[model samples]
Target: MSIAEERIDRLHTLAKQAVAAREFDRSREYVRLARRIAERNRCGLPREFKRFSCPRCDVYLRPGVNARVRTQDGHVVVTCDCGELKRYPYQS
Candidate 1:
C-alpha cells in the first residue's frame, strides 16, 4: 500500500482505540486528520473507515453508544447521535 494509505489505516486504528477509551475528541481529531490526508492525496477513505464515522459530526460511531443500527427491508440504517442517518444497501 502507499504511504498515505498506510497512514490512513493507522489513523483508523487509533480512532477506534480512542473511542473505545472514551476519548471522543481525540477520536474525532483522528478522523478529521485521516480525511484531510485522503483529500490531499486524492484518495478515498476505506469502506470500514467511512462506515464507522459520522459525516455530519465527524464522530467515531460505536453502535449502542453514539450510534443506533437497524436493518430495514433492503438496507442497514445507522443513526448517529447528531441525527445523521446513513443507509447502506445489503442483499439478504
Candidate 2:
C-alpha cells in the first residue's frame, strides 16, 4: 500500500482506540486528519473506516455507545448520535 494509505490505516486504528478510551474528541480529530490525508492524496477512505465514522460529525462510532445499529429489510442501518444515518446492504 502507499504511504498515505498506511497513514490512514494507522489513523483508523488510533481513532478506534480513542473511542474505546472514551476520548471522543481525539477520535474525531483522528478521523478528520485521515479524511484530509485521503483528500490530499486523491484516494478514497477504506470501507471499514468509512463505515465506522460519522460523515456529518467526523466521530468514530461505537455501536451501542455513540451509534445505534438496526437491520431493516435487506440493509443494515447505522444511526449516529449526531442524527446521521447510513445504510449498507447485507446478504442476510
Best by lDDT: 2
The lowest-lDDT stretch of 10 consecutive residues in candidate 1 is 57-66
lDDT of 2 at 6: 97
Clashing residue pairs found in predicted model 2: none
TM per prediction: 0.97, 0.97
User: All models: lDDT?
Assistant: 0.96, 0.97
Candidate 1's C-alpha lDDT? 0.96
Q: Residue 11 error for model 1, in Å?
A: 0.4
Supply candidate 1's per-residue lDDT for 76: 98
Off by over 4 Å in 1: none
Candidate 2 Cα outliers beyond 4 Å, as residue runs: none
